[model samples]
Target: MRNANVMTASSEGALCSATRRIMLISPMPNRVRNLLAALTDHCFDVFSLHEWDDGMLDSLKPQLVIYDALPIASQPDAYNRWREQELQKASSRMNIPLLLLMPEEERQSLENKASVHVMRWPSEPEAALLEIKRIAERAQDVYDSRRAGESIVFKDLTIDPGKMIVTRGPEQIGLTKTEYDLLLHFITSDGSVQTREALLDIVWGQQFYAGSNVVDVHIKSLRKKLQDNAVSPRYIATVRGAGYRLADQ
Candidate 1:
């Protein structure tokens, strides 16, 4: 007989292998047992904590954080305020979504925020699981759309295609048209080595002489502007026999 604890392919079809990481924060462990089990059954990798740790979010990197605030709702107003503030701080820094589970009566007490979703507590396990899945799926969609329109980040370097800007840490790096095109090509190549001939066609086009060393000249200028050391590069790296590729790190 298949163990009930084991997730089968049919059972995992909804969430599948691409399960989202969920951080569940609850003071009342007894009350959350059923919800935790349900989440596990649905293929969510849950990290449960009795209390909030400021560093947990950064370390665990959960896509969604569910804070069971029902226990805190009955506490002194001051204690509730402190808890909310801590949750806000952690969620804002990581820009992850927060799902606050509270009593229906306490709904009006909390203000709505883009990153925060509130759901009534003491719900049936299946109902809570459905709501949690809905919130998580919506959050993932928003994140995907935002990332599609956002800057490309590699290590400490950020490339904003929309603004046509590149920055290494706090300093902005300027590049000429050819240099910018070359750097952008390397980034989009997904760290794959680009041969000189390939890069010439992509960035310089076929109009330029095939034997010209213009690629090397512009790459040097780009490296200097971005403060990348070819010998020990932080951004771009040369593959010797091959051509250039973005740094893996």
Candidate 2:
């Protein structure tokens, strides 16, 4: 029997021989428990809870989340409130990939936030595990790629793709991993006004809704770093409703 208590919060920092620390976020305790077993079979450290807890969350930073987006019609508004809070900070602290459980319509409606990956529940546990592992693996790949982009420089701004480090003139800009990837995408595109569709295709590959304000949100952060101005835009350039471009001047 595999001992579930031996796993850490992180999936061995990058890649583990185990399935890594996977948090199953479902309102139902039974579902959480069952999924925990599935994760266990894959050698993962699993955490389960009816609602988000500050202290527990503060300690274990999960690498991946299996978010069962079951409707909260009767589950109380508290669960909904709790989810909003957790989802808000999740992308910031850890770029954990989420598997949302909801109706196809609900999943389509959530087509806005790029922070979470929404998927209707799968029929087979094996297939579900496959999807879970695939997302987690891709997340690791993204993290690895950003490391090399850490030292990338764009005129006034200097970004170390390897370390997720960014420096603008004298001040530094702290960017999330997604933010960093978006910036790098513009840089590597050869000053092209990469459409949101292209950005979605290139950056996320096939994770979630790539066309969401995720691009806008990340660009907003990038603009702040480049000193939001009209003089020379510096790093990222606005192609106006089309997409964004990396400016030379």
Candidate 3:
């Protein structure tokens, strides 16, 4: 456990012979931590971190990495910069799955490189775990379907699903998994107005929070990445209080 506050949460079930190791690089709320404890028996070993280190990557060799990208507010610029650099190194150097939970305000400020997945914080533990499982499955699919070379063309944007890459004209747009999936849903729906609830169900696979503006934040992020104007948009269109659409027509 080192310096982390560790907990073993599990129900009445025999422990699995093999367990997937998870290195959590953030502070979880007590309620969420309690929920995560249920997963310990389900073949999951979670370890939270109060600090960052490169040696952990070598020693832990975790199957997945979940990190917090929240602002310290008090930390000096140099300290924050160094931590970010180290985080990047950990992601790039290790070919494992990396999930980042950050404040919506900090999303644009952080680099989207290194194939790191992003999700908003203050999420339900079960929902977060479910999302992580989905990502793991998708990663496996990518590995197995490496030779398929599958891609989808939506207007000027070309999405390579297998590689999780999006290219518009000549430049490649770096998008987190959620952003890419949301865009894919919009494009495939052919500009149909998608309700916020529906978007949450489809993209997140679960509605973790009701009346949360998480959807809007992600949509805003997608628009920014696609260079689509919010007002008189070329691609994504906000349907006032209704929802959002791809603006196909």
Error of 1 at 34 (Å): 1.2
Sequence-dependent TM-score of model 3: 0.47
User: TM-score for all predictions?
Assistant: 0.51, 0.53, 0.47
Model 3 ranges off by over 4 Å: 1-9, 27-38, 76-79, 108-114, 138-249
lDDT of 3 by residue, 1-249 (tens): 344433344455554665567777754334245434654645577766655666876787766777766656676576568656755565334545677776666654443332356776666667777877766655544443444766767678887877889998889999999998888766654243566766776677653665548899999999999999988888898877667777755
Model 3 root-mean-square deviation: 12.9
Candidate 1, TM-score vs. the true structure? Answer: 0.51
**Winning model by lDDT:** 1
Q: Rank the candidates by lDDT, best first.
A: 1, 3, 2
Cα RMSDs of all predictions?
18.0, 10.8, 12.9
Better of 1 and 3 by TM-score: 1
Q: How much lDDT does candidate 2 score? A: 0.61
Per-candidate Cα lDDT values, in order, are: 0.70, 0.61, 0.66
For model 3, what is the C-alpha lDDT against the true structure? 0.66
Per-residue lDDT over 1-249 for candidate 2, one digit per residue giving the tens place of the 0 to 100 score: 122244433423544454567666565655545556666666777877655554555577666766765656776577666666665555333334556666677677654443456666535566677877877776555455565553555676676765667787778787777777887666644343455655665566546664557767767876765566534676766665556666665
Per-residue error at 6 for model 1, in Å? 12
- Candidate 2 segments whose C-alpha is farther than 4 A from its true place: 1-17, 76-78, 144-249
| Residue 109 alpha-carbon offset, candidate 2, angstroms | 1.4
Candidate that scores best on TM-score: 2
